[model samples]
Structures are given as C-alpha cells and as structure tokens.
Target: MEECCRLGLAKSIGVSNYSCAKLSTLLQNATILPAVNRVELNVAWQQQKLIEFCKDKGIHVCAFSPLGAYGFHWGTNAVMDSPILKDIATAKDKTVAQVALRWVREQGAFPIVRSLNKERMRQNLQIFDWELTDEEVRRIRQIPQQRACTWKEVVSPDGQYKSLEELWDGEI
Candidate 1:
C-alpha cells in the first residue's frame, strides 16, 4: 500500500472497524499512518477515547451507522427511540436523527448517514444549521450505550476473534 501511494496509484489509505488498540498496533509497524478510521459511532455509542486518539494521531474519524442501523437485524433502535434524544429534539425543534448526527459532528468525526428516501436524506443534512448546547452534550454523553452490531452471529469459529471482546479488542 505504501508503494502504491508512492507510485500515486492510490492516493491514501483508510481502515474500518479499527479500534484504538488495533490502530496502535498497526501504527507501530506501518510505514504511513492511516488517513481515516471508520467505525460505528453515534450519540448513544460515542467512542470518545478512540476519537481523541485518532485526532491526536492526525487520522480523521468517520462514523458509520450514526443512526444506529435501526431496522437491520444486527442493529438497534437505541438512537432513534431514545427518550433523551426525543426530548432534545422537541426542545430544539429538530428530529431525533438530526440531533444524533449533529452530536456526531460536534464530536469532530464525519458521520455517515444512509437513507433511501429523499426527504429523509434531506433532513439528515439539516443538522449543520444548529448546535447542541453544553448541557445538551453533557446529557447526551450519559445515554446508555449498547453495541448494536455485535458481529456475534457472523464470526467464524476458526476466526481470529472467538468472542465480541476479542473482536473489538475490548474496546466495546
């Protein structure tokens, strides 16, 4: 990959599902640091330490499943149905989704939101117009966190990770 970058065949390199521990190990032996670390992040499941570490390493953090992947089998409605987020949405006159994505943005990570509906897609971009107050951010930080995508059912028995703890390197 470094050779590809040097030859201008690949502009940069990015990684997904990389925990801080994994990134630390990779950084030690890798020639060039990663340009981005894409991971599951949202208001409820905020990965603060990972984000801060990426920031310190000059690697941009890209948040995937920012809406909690609500309807998927491995996903949960935790972010969308949160009472705290609902309350904030009501007070802010914005949808819960907007608040969640805005929270992700305020965390200094780029949030990846997916929606097939055009109106829903448009609403996702509406978060930039407003900001969450310090009190709001504090309350959000206290929300109960649960790993929506545990990767339990998908992992092979012979795979490197035998359990969720191993898969996330205890980061979860």
Candidate 2:
C-alpha cells in the first residue's frame, strides 16, 4: 500500500476493522498514514476511544453497519429497534434509520449504509438535514455497548487472534 501510494497508483490507503492498538503499530511503521479506517460502528457499538485516536491522527473513521446491519444475516434489530432511537425518531418525525444515520454523522464519521432499495437509499441521505439533541445523544451514550458482528469464522485458536478480545485488541 505504501508503494502504491508512492507510485501514485492509489491516492490513499485505508484499513478495515483495525483497532487503535493495531493502528498505533501501523502508524509507527507506515511511511504513508492510512486515509481512513473502516469499522463496524453504530449507536450501540460505539467505539469512542478508537474514534478519538483516529481523530487525533487525522484518519477518517468510516462507519460500517451504521444502521446496525439490521435485517441482514450478521445483523440484529438492536439498533433499529432501540427504544431510545425509536423515541427520538418519533419526536423528530423521522424514521429510526434516519436517526441512527444522523447520529453516526454527528459523531464526525462517514456512514456507509448498504441498501438496494431506491427509496431507502434516498431516505438514508436525509440524515444530514437534521441533528440529534444533546439529551438524545446522552441517552444513546448510555445504551449498552456490544459488538454485533462476532466474526466467529475468522477468529480461531490456530489463527492470529484466539478470541474476540485479541481480535479487537481488547477494544471489544
């Protein structure tokens, strides 16, 4: 990736699912710092420390599963079905998805929403028009944080990461 960046083949390099610990090591050795770090982020699984570290390093935090990946194989209804988010959406006259996306944006991260439906895609873009209240954000901050994607198939006893804690560098 450094070679690609130096050669001008790729304008910038980005990493995915990298913890702050891994990024610290990468920053030490990398000639070219990563432009972005993509990770699973949502109201429930907010990696606040990681976000701050990346912010300090000037690395953009791109949120994957910003809506909690709801209605998908590895997704759960925890985000969309959250009582707090639902209440906020109700008060704002917006959908739960919009509230969630807005929250992701409000955190100074770019949300990567996956949707094939045209209307849904259009609705996802509506987040930028509004903002979450401080109280709403506080309520969201109190929601129990847990990683939704376990990635059971990737982490193994024989693999580099023996457990979730190791895989997430204890950020989980």
Candidate 3:
C-alpha cells in the first residue's frame, strides 16, 4: 500500500464489507483516510455504529442495497405483509417502498437502492420533499437487525470469523 502511495499508482484507497477491527488496522497503517467503504446498509441492516464512526472521521460510507431488497426470501414478512409501513405511507402519502428508501436517505450517507421497475425508479426519488421524525427514525432503527444476505462461502466453517457476529466485530 505504501509502495502504491509512494508511486502515486492509486488515486485513493478504500474497502468493502470490512469490520471496525479491520478498518482500525487499515487506519493504523494508512497515511490517508480511505475515500469510501462500501457496505450493506438499508432499513433492514443499518450498521449505525460504523456509520457514526466513519462520519466522525470523515470517511465516506456508501450504502449497498439500501431498499432492504424486496422479493428476497429471507426478508421479514412484515417487509411484505405488514400494514404498518403502509399506514406510515398513508400519513406521508407515499409508497411503502418510498418510506424504506427515504429512511436511508435521511441518514447522512449515500444509499445505492436498485429496482427494475420504472415506477419504482420515480418513487424512490421522491424522498426530498418529506422526512421522518426522530420517533420514526427510532422505529425504523428498531426493525430487527437482520442481514438480508449473508455469504457463508466467504469463511471456513470452523474459522474464528465463522458467524456474522464475529465478522461484524460484535457490533451487530
């Protein structure tokens, strides 16, 4: 890394899906703050502590899958079945999907939400006009911290980082 920096071969350095422990190690060895750390962040998996830490240090956090990935099997039925978000939608006069997308925008980082529908394309962009209250933010924060996607193939079965708990540095 130092060699690259010395040679000016790279513009900036960053990481993806790294825990605070790993980030701490990188920071210890790096002279420049990373430009970004890409991570899974959305209504379902907020990663609040890491987000706060990165903000405090002026490191950019780019959220991946910020809509909580609708149509995935692992997502809560509440994500699909509940009328609660719909009620909130009625209050906001926006789509439930918009509420989910807007929740992430309300946070102080960039969210990369994706969809195949053109209507969703338009709805997702409607977050600027309205906002969620602190209580609503708290409620969104409490929506059960579950990763919509986990790749077991990345770690050995008996490895020290075998579980998501260990991988996330006990912060989940």
Task: Tell me the whole-model lDDT of each prediction, alpha carbons only.
Answer: 0.90, 0.91, 0.74
Q: What does the lDDT come to for candidate 1? A: 0.90
lDDT of 3 by residue, 1-172 (tens): 5568669998877788876777888889888788888887877687888888888878888877776656666544444333556667788788887787677677777878777889888887888898898877767766777776675455566776687777767766
**Model 2 C-alpha lDDT per residue in residues 73-105, reported as the tens digit of each score:** 998788998999999999999999999999989
| RMSD of each candidate relative to the true structure | 1.2, 0.9, 2.6
Q: Model 1 RMSD to the real structure?
A: 1.2
Count: clashes, candidate 3 = 0
Tens digit of per-residue lDDT, candidate 1, span 106-153: 999999888889999999989888999999999999899877877787
Question: Which segments of model 3 are wrong by more than 4 Å?
Answer: 1-10, 73-83, 158-160
Candidates sorted on lDDT, descending: 2, 1, 3
Judging by lDDT, tell me the better candidate of 1 and 3: 1
Q: Which stretches of candidate 2 lie over 4 Å from their true place?
A: none
Ranking by TM-score: 2, 1, 3
Q: Count the backbone clashes (under 3 Å) in each candidate.
A: 0, 0, 0
Best-fitting candidate, scored by TM-score: 2
lDDT of 3 at 27: 86
